[model samples]
Target: MLEEIESSAHSSGVISMDNATRYLRPTGIDPIMGKVLNWLPKLGISIAGSRLLAVRGRKSGQWRTTMVNVLTAADGTRYLVAPRGHTQWVRNLRAAGEGELRLGRRTEHFTATELADADRVPLLRLYLEKWGWEVGRFFDGITKDATDAELAAVAPGFPVFRLA
Candidate 1:
């Protein structure tokens, strides 16, 4: 009984260590999952996947990178929409009005736009339907069929930057 208990403890310790890597590794997904995420954008897909964006800080003027969801517009332009109302990246873009999106190996310039609420109503509805739970609780009380006035109220906070 004593020998069996010692063996179980040793095996459990190894399992725990292996589990730690699951959280520590950034590309923790298997090759298949990684491939799926990489190809998602090519298929004209918007699968709630985010990429690291490097933008000049508003005050500091230093390079800052943060993960953001990618949203494509009708005119073949890509945008970074901030649904959270107030985030550091949104604030940075509002101040600097320019940034670069780092998607995998490519980086693209983008011009910021603090869209009016009425202007973003349609986009917001699409976001809620497509992004689903990935957008967090930001739009909880905000109705999908919000009026122009309601959209404008929230528009200042949810800025959209067009890729240049």
Candidate 2:
């Protein structure tokens, strides 16, 4: 079944099933920590640049929210990377193409463009460098110190979106 999906994806020039399914490494969610993370942002405190990301669900059309680290490049571009790889938010954002990032009472809505795998290397390195302490475990041992080739090799497994 997965093979059929992969074959169809390749033929259609869409993301492959293997690329979508192979890299999802979900760590157990600590309920206490989850509550804290979600609560802090509502009180106007961001944990190391975390934001409450709210993207509309593709199937349900309901808004789904999660805590995420937003990375800002030196040139001032902002990005969102899925360290867990092709997550639900990634799929939702891919379908909706836009979402909101909430910090306190501020909700900034933006459209996102998914970066090609080739363009993800530097962003991945920068993201790891910034939020690695929190998200590093999801990267399969890849770190900010990884070589460009190493980062590139694992880029497809991670989905990066450039926000505008």
Candidate 3:
């Protein structure tokens, strides 16, 4: 259990990244599910076959981690999307510029480069196609059927990262 620990990096001493329209849904079943998913990687099982992403905290320099669904495109490129709208992990990854994707005993460390909104259409489509049942509500009703324009409209809210 992670108690609220204060860091000197912010005026509030709590790690809250500045964002104009971040959506923080109530933490209910999410924490419990997150704990289970986080533990599964150590046992060689992915919660729904997704990786556990870990990034260094911008403020505390400690590792903050969460279950992330990794998407692989037809061209073999991979992406990480933040469906929760610029959550802590997204902010930390942006700050650290690198992180690890882990499952079981395998850990692949790579640098993360945030993709621009203009380039996120296809990736976002694939993401929604794959995980819509789990994260669609966060997207404000946009689905795989949404045109590029609609996606672009909501693109700025979701942060997509390309790992190399």
Candidate 4:
């Protein structure tokens, strides 16, 4: 199992990468989709049960909000994943430590703990099993059936946060 990634950014607030260079394409249709989902929760609806995640930005000192999927495994652990990879919300949650998952009037307040790559195998599989239709394209065609080694090889690219 892998233990950690080579990232310079920690919950302690040292960041070496920015939005444009961190992931594949942080500014694209997905951001627009998130904006739409953020509005839906206000109207008491969701697409595939996604929620609006609102957290304080690490730099802006203001609420940075986006839509994210809350993954609940069979073991009952909850998680938030960045399928397109290291997004602003992921960075904010890392710096801020907690956030809220909202749908209309209902909100789930959570403290987030980012999981290291070596520890993400099973959860990655579960997430793909449940949300592949929505996020599979980001995985370079890797699916739930990908082996542990295969998943691990690409795990560093997907930032996962366990919420409590």
Q: Which candidate has the highest TM-score of all?
A: 2
lDDT (tens digit, per residue) of candidate 2 on 39-148: 77777789888899999999999999888899999999999998867878999999999999998899999999999999999999999989888888767689999999
Worst 10 residues of 2 by lDDT: 22-31
Ranking by TM-score: 2, 3, 4, 1
Off by over 4 Å in 4: 1-22, 26-28
| Superposed model 2: Cα runs more than 4 Å off | 1-18, 23-26, 29-32
Q: List the residue pairs that clash in candidate 4.
A: 2-118
Local lDDT at 87 for model 3: 77
Error in Å for residue 33 of model 1? 18
* TM-score of every candidate: 0.60, 0.84, 0.83, 0.82
Q: Which residue runs of candidate 1 sit more than 4 Å off their true CA positions?
A: 1-49, 143-153
Task: Put down candidate 4 lDDT per residue, 43-152, tens digits, no spaces.
Answer: 77887768888899899889877777888878788999888677677788999999988888998889999998888888889889999998897777889999999988
- Pitting candidate 2 against candidate 3, the one with the higher lDDT is 2
What are the per-model numbers of colliding residue pairs? 2, 0, 1, 1
lDDT of 3: 0.80
lDDT by residue (tens digit), candidate 1, 1-164: 96676566445332111211211112234335646664544443434556666678889999877666877667766667676545567668878888876665666777777665457766766666667466635554666666767755665556566656
Clashing residue pairs, backbone N/CA/C < 3 A, model 1: 117-151, 117-152
Top lDDT prediction, candidate number: 2
Model 4 lDDT at residue 121: 85
